[model samples]
Target chain A: MVPISYYLILAAVLFSIGVLSFLLKRNVVTVFMSIELMLNAVNLTFVAFAHRWQAVSPQAVSGQIFVFFVMVVAAAEAAVGLAIIISIFRTRQTLNIDQINLMKN
Target chain B: MQLALFIIFAALAVAGALNFLLQRHPINSALSLVVVMLSLAVLYWSLGAEFLAAAQVIVYSGAVMVLFVFVVMLLNAGEEERTTGSRAAYFAGIPGAAAVFCLLSFVFLSESKTLGSSNLGGYLNDGTVNIVEISKILFTRLLLPFEVTSILILVAILGAVVLARKEPDPKVVTSSTDAAGVIVIKEKV
Candidate 1:
């Protein structure tokens, strides 16, 4: 049996990596990917906790259900976000986040 | 056996995430993300969330990643240029991430005894099938949110279509108007 802490620690590591990439990366798409990674990390944590509590109560499956909703939201976000990225690229002709400062005047 | 599988897939997931960060091209990063998602799906399976494991693979690795790759190819995005970047991000971001990791690790480790342990496919011993148990709750307790997500998907589709459509060229519109004006002038003459 793996300690629940191990799963949580892995999730924490993944999330930190996501944050690092989100901060350091210049490309908008890659930053978006990092956000997805963060969401994935959170989903992992939810599943881990759900598994941990499954022995206690049947309602613990709600964690997995929450993950379902998270995935749904992620799918919607990806669709809309990539479309927004496409439009941004169409107008700016660049994907670098630093150069995208039209409103920074 | 379960511990070995968890360690292997966890390593794969971390490696994929690091590759995602290191890649110079968006396409490479996107592919690395797919690897991470797949490995996470395996982890989900190990955790006994069978339906979630399948959904993770199908929706995340399959659908969302395909969307990312399509956009990357459509835009023909080139390699990311290495910029010196802002001093603040360099000074703050790495430390911030490290701090967050340390904080989470400390908390989780401290609570490990209370949080307990999990076995691979441990939930299967309960005799209820995983998918059925999930659906029973999902359709009953979680039905409202389920319906809401359908609406959310619909809105996303509409937004994507509207946002990604090419703007009508102002130059083409002006030229068409100019042509119409010339025809009107010639008719009058």
Candidate 2:
């Protein structure tokens, strides 16, 4: 049997990397991808805990179910986020985050 | 055996995530993200979340990332210019992150003996937790949140369409007379 800690450690490592990218990357899309990475890391942790809790109760599958909703919400967020990114790119004529400073122009 | 499988996939996932972060072009980052998602799906399967594994692949890798790639192409998102932030941040940033990673891993290792020490082959012992069971629980207990999610997606679609579309010409608005009885001259293009 594989230890649950191994999965958790992996998630933690992945999440730290996600944070690093989120802070370091300049392109809005790259930063956005890092957010996805962070979400994936969280999903891994949830599944690990879900696996551990499977022995206790009837609601053994709750973690998995939550992961389902997280994915749905991520999809919606990506749609709106990318649309905003594209809109910014159109008006500002640049995808660089430093340039898109105006609130309404 | 389970340890081996987990190690391999986890390594792949981390490598993919690194590639996504390091790549300059948005397209390359998007592709690496796909790799990360696929490996995570495999990890979910190993954890016996069969339905979640499938959903992770289908929705995240298939749909969400495809949208990312689409927008990357549509916007012509180019390589990120290296920001010349303070020299102190560039020097301290990575080491700071490494410190955080070390701290977190230290905590995880300390807890490993208590939390991680579970027997393998749990799925073989416990009857399969399949799609039907997940759906049964979801439809009954989680019904409201599911409905709310549907509405959220609908709003996202509307918002995306509205935000991305070009606005009507300002000259067209000028053609109509104002209520204050002011003469609004229609400029000839």
Candidate 3:
């Protein structure tokens, strides 16, 4: 038997790495990728909790349902975000966030 | 056996994430993320989330990642120029992340008592019944959100087309449309 806590802790570690990567990376696409990583980490936690609660709330399945909504939103976000990135690249000719700062001046 | 599977796949997932982060080329990072997503799907399957595991692969790795790779190719996104950072960030970032990991581990480990140990296939309700119940709640309880998400996808499609369209010069539009028609004619040829 694998402890649910192991999954929870693994999710936390992945989340932390996502945060770290988001902070460290300068490429806009990589940053977006990091955000996806964080989203997956959260999904892991949701599934673990869903498994734990299945015995208690057999009918609700709220945790798994939450994961479904998250996946949907993520797909939408990816489509929109990539399109936005394409436009930004068209205008700015760069994918580096450090150079895309227009409002800073 | 279950524990071994968990450990192996979890390690693969975390390693993939790290490789994604460390890789400089956007394409490389994108591929690494594919790896991470695949391993995560396996992990989801282990957790008895059969539908979710399948969905993760189709939506996340297949669709989302293809989108990412397409954008990378379209934009010709180059390798990021490596720059030296503030000493403070490197020195502080590692330790700070470590501290947070330790803290979270402590909390999760302590709370493990309530979560209990889960065996593989512990969620072995009737497979068909599982899908039926999920669909029941999805169509009934969560129906509104589901409908809204379809609308959201439609809006996103529109937004992508709008955002990616070339500037609206009337002559350019006509010329491009004519060129697009030529493309179709050429395709048939």
What DockQ does every candidate get?
0.82, 0.67, 0.66
Per-candidate TM equals 0.92, 0.89, 0.88
- On lDDT, who's better, 1 or 3? 1
What's the residue-level lDDT of A18 in candidate 3? 86
Q: Order of candidates by DockQ, top first?
A: 1, 2, 3
**Pairs clashing within candidate 2:** A1-B120
Candidate 1 or 2, higher TM-score? 1
lDDT of 2 by residue, B1-189 (tens): 877888899999999988987888989999999999999998888887778888898999999899999988988777889876446555777788788889878887898877754444334354655576688888998899889999999999999999888887666434656899877878755
lDDT per residue for candidate 1 within B82-109, as digits (tens), equals 8866778889989999999999999999
The window of 10 residues in a row where model 2 chain B has the poorest summed lDDT is: B117-126
| For candidate 3, the TM-score of chain A alone relative to the native chain A | 0.96
Whole-model alpha-carbon lDDT for candidate 3: 0.85
Q: Candidates 2 and 3: which is better by lDDT?
A: 3
Model 3 docking category: medium
Candidate order by lDDT, decreasing, is 1, 3, 2
Error of 2 at A102 (Å): 2.3
**Residue A67 in candidate 1, Cα distance off native in Å:** 0.4
Q: Residue B134 lDDT in model 1? A: 86
What does each candidate score in C-alpha RMSD? Answer: 3.6, 3.1, 7.6
Q: What is candidate 2's lDDT per residue for A14-101, written digit by digit as tens?
A: 9888888877877888889889999999999998888888745534777878888888889899988988888788777887766666
Q: Model 2: how far is B7 from its true place, Å? A: 1.2
